[model samples]
Target: MRRSLRLLAACTIVALVCCGCGTIAVRKTSNVLDYLYPEGSPAIPARDVTLTLPLRVGVAFAPGGTATRRGASDWVNATAMGGEVTEAQKLALLERIAEAFRDRDYIASVDPIPSLYLAPGGSFDNLDQLAQAMGLNVVVLLSYDQAQFNETTNWSITYWTLVGAYVVKGENNQTQTFVDAAVYDIPSRALLFRTAGSDVRGGRSTPVESPEAFRAESAKSFEEAIDDLIRNLADGLKVFGEEATTGRVRGQGTPEIEVKAAPGYSGVAKFENGRYSGALGPVELGLVGLLVVAGLARRRSA
Candidate 1:
């Protein structure tokens, strides 16, 4: 028992060294999305004076499958254990995005029609019929994938233990992720956009002597990986015309964000709306602090 306990403690420490706080903070602190579809942009018919957007979209699980997670609970409690987002959650993501566009007077709607994955028998042909039934113009299909690196090697120094760590995300054999995305122009049958999430730390496994500790550490990566994808899509959509929808949609920008940190602390702002565009680091809000602390506690327990 003593040996087991000590091993657990040591492994837990090592995991924390690699994981930091292990919790992603999704705070859209402040952002303002405003834009006009330029005549140069994709031209579509303005059926009504209101010009309802051909804005039907989807939220799906990673194209193939989600990496299996053992030890602790998944990064997002709401996300299903497997790689897929729940039906309700997918709907929610699309709905919120639709609402955002609508708030800006861009008439849009989320197709009630399930995605190809959700409806196996349903294909693009069926989708056309379904969209026509709902009076939808274009349909957008979305998916996501992620990769994480939590490399921590241990070496004994002359007097102290050295835990070699690389917490910042990287792609390698020891990573976990969820990714894959595509946008279809139902009207023109054109491929407006298609891309995969950053599979940086592809298939790299974080094997903790303590599975629980490893999970606690890995969950943060998983959560943040997904959040990063979402934020990229959201912010990219929010800023529409300033940049191409490709690289930006996949989080390939030089700018950084400013967010809010711990109490009595100031951090980087999370999102980059038309009003503000840049990169954001970790936040230090009270809620996030609690989460981080909890991860720390879990690490300690491990």
Candidate 2:
């Protein structure tokens, strides 16, 4: 009986040591630079850009790291263990972003583009094709980087006992996420503006529950970061509008870009020389006509 007890004690010690001996780290990311300028920046002659009002816009997630270069469809499967961002999640997030621009006076429509439509490291030519196919004048690309680390805490020693692995909160998880949005004029290939957001979260879970807990934490971190991105994006949009209107967007020497209503759009607004020109709408025009007739009748009576 004494020898048996000693052997069991030694086994427990080895199990406890093994439980806390290793750390697990996972990383997943999508990079806009890799997707848009994979061959490095190319030199092209500068030309003035003409922005037609009521612009059609497209939004999409950029392809992830080189491992996913096989195509975006492979991303989920390849990074499954790392808690890959799902297509459904991407669509929902894109819809929220589209809603932000959909009601703008200068925007006609905002479409959420699927990652499948984009090739990894396809560059500007890919965007050109997408724009032509989708009738998009402007495009917004979203990219993200996330890292998660799992470590055993001091409480992990309890995991030496089989039941403790299921009941003791011994695993510590840390997740960090960052997301970015870049707006571009497809025709001109000019970067109009950009915005970004990030978040970090930490929690402890029982060893048996660590996988689920880590995934949940990662998802929550992404949602929080995106919320922040939206707020910052709104501010960036405002600044871009102000700069574009004042002719300061591309600097002084650059020719002012013309802005006009699309061929069939009925809105009576125009932009010339970097200034907004508001014209009377039908209701306003009718009111002015009534006032003119009233004045003429009063003059004849006098």
Q: Mind giving the per-residue lDDT tens digits that candidate 1 earns over 1-302?
A: 99999998997786545443233211111000001122244543321111123344533332222343333211222122233334554455455444544433232344434343333323355546755766665555554433323332231111122222223122122445444444444544444344433322323222222233334334444454545555565654545423332323223432221112333423222223325457555654666889999999999999
How much lDDT does each candidate structure score? 0.38, 0.75
Provide the lowest-lDDT 10-residue window in model 1: 27-36
Give per-residue CA lDDT, model 2, range 1-302, as digits (tens): 99999999998777666666556667768888888877666754335667787889999999754222121111012233345678787888788888866766667889999888999888788999999999999899999988877777667767656687789887777888899999878888777778998999999888677767867887788889888898888778767766677654455765455666777886534321233578779999999999999999999999
TM-scores for all predictions: 0.39, 0.74
State the RMSD for candidate 1: 20.4
**Top TM-score prediction, candidate number:** 2
Candidate 1: segments with Cα more than 4 A from true spot: 1-102, 111-117, 120-122, 147-178, 194-223, 234-302
Query: How does model 1 score by TM-score?
Result: 0.39
Displacement of residue 231 (Cα, Å) in model 2 is: 0.7
